[model samples]
Target: MTHQTLPTGSVSPEQAAREQSLVDEVVASFAGAESPRLRELMEALARHVHAFVRETRLTEEEWAAAIEFLTAVGHITDDKRQEFILLSDALGLSMQTITVNNEAVGAATEATVFGPFFVEGAPRIELGGDLAFGAKGQPCWVEGTVTDTEGRPLPGARIEVWEADEDGFYDVQYGDGRTAARAHLFTDDNGAYRFWAVTPTPYPIPHDGPVGQMLQAVGRSPMRASHLHFMVSAEGQRTLVTHIFVAGDDYLTHDSVFGVRDSLVRDFALQPAGTPTPDGRDLGDTEWTRTRFDIVLAPAQTASTS
Candidate 1:
């Protein structure tokens, strides 16, 4: 007796083309959606996704795995944390998006990504105040002037500052009841601001999620360069979100997220105990590190007039 062979399940060329046509049809229907902004975003996303599928000829198993990964990312998020933001950071998308949105306006201060750690309503302190709150780390003094594009001081500029301890961990990471390493300070009449805090050290990003898994798979470390975060703004100038990186950090050349700019790296000098403070207050018996940084802002017309 002879047996008959059955047809294979794989699609023919014609069938594949028909499948693509269906995708295009569905994407085209989005033009009739009510929200203009949503429609625009969906259209762009659809175009890129369709192109990616076509280029890579992605498999069903790979697509399902991608969905599962994204679902896990969402499941891990809560009120005080965002796993997706961490994912964006590890992928360098966060910094890239910030760069795209914040173009330098005529030599204005550079803007960097605002990481997820900044909590609203940090306690405001006067210029020359101590942000360290007596925390443990090498003492560090940060003094800088906020200025407009023409080199004029911008008085009363609000500056928000935050950094990890010398051990490279933020208060939030250490749980509650800790307020030793963050503060908000306003510029003085001369556009000058000063604060005392612990020197920041290189720290690792959260490495217990999908993003972390990806990093391990690629043999990459998650440590960022030692740096201090700053958000500075004035009434008539553009807001600047940036970091002052410690010079000679091992990770400077290999910052996992590519956030380092040459102009932003600075040297921290060792000052003997009892060194005179900028405000004439003596830091007795406390050897400290000091660094001066000056931020230049662009006028309103040069800032966001674009």
Candidate 2:
């Protein structure tokens, strides 16, 4: 009798049946979930994760190493730094979540990552007030209008803005309990707003932790493109978290967090010292940059009651 050899990685019928049985059992465990959505999510998660393990033929040693890496990620996370967000951003999960949650509505502005550095209760600034608060960098004048999808002005919109200084460091990174380069201001009656912010410079995400190690292992850079962050919200509108990338930034194509969007890129025009400013704030012997970012908000999605 001649024996037929199976191809590489092929399992016999009995073994395949055993593997499938395990997956079924795991998925079945979620049947008792109180929420229908929770049950569905847990079951789907179990199936997909099991499929991944089966497809990869993942070894026990590799699973152990992954658990250890995740442990390190949790250990390094703190109020000042979020290692998990870095990991998600590095893996493109953050962007994927944003895409799933933020369906495009007409010409509404696109949304991006709500980076880990955002802090609550930021100081409120009046229109055209400076946001730098003495942080080091070239001065930039940021102006914009907030309007609805129909181009109607949305007055009283709240805009929260933050960015790393020229040296690629947020105020939170200094460990000195200081707040700079971050502020919140409201739109005026005309839905217009402006502020003095430092010109954003490209900077690396926090990469000293396990996420950084993972990126290094895959030969990836942790550099994010130069951009200013914004979180805009108005009554009866969906809140938007996004960034305005500086046009011509070298890292636009390879932003570590995958947060760059073509629509969000804007020109940061350089002005020679002594050029007349719109509001005329004097900067002796210092050149400045300016950019305009118009924001459009989508109508908030209402829950279906039917």
CA lDDT of every candidate: 0.81, 0.90
In model 2, where do residues sit more than 4 Å from their true spots?
A: 1-9, 302-306
For model 1, the run of ten residues with the poorest summed lDDT: 1-10
Which one wins on TM-score? 2
Q: Give the per-residue lDDT of model 1 (tens digit) for 52-89.
A: 66556678998998899899888888886788988888
What local lDDT score does residue 107 receive in model 1, on the 0 to 100 scale? 62
In model 1, the clashing pairs are none
* Residue 128 C-alpha lDDT in model 2: 96
TM-score of 2: 0.93
Q: Each prediction's TM-score against the native?
A: 0.88, 0.93
Candidate 2: which pairs clash? none
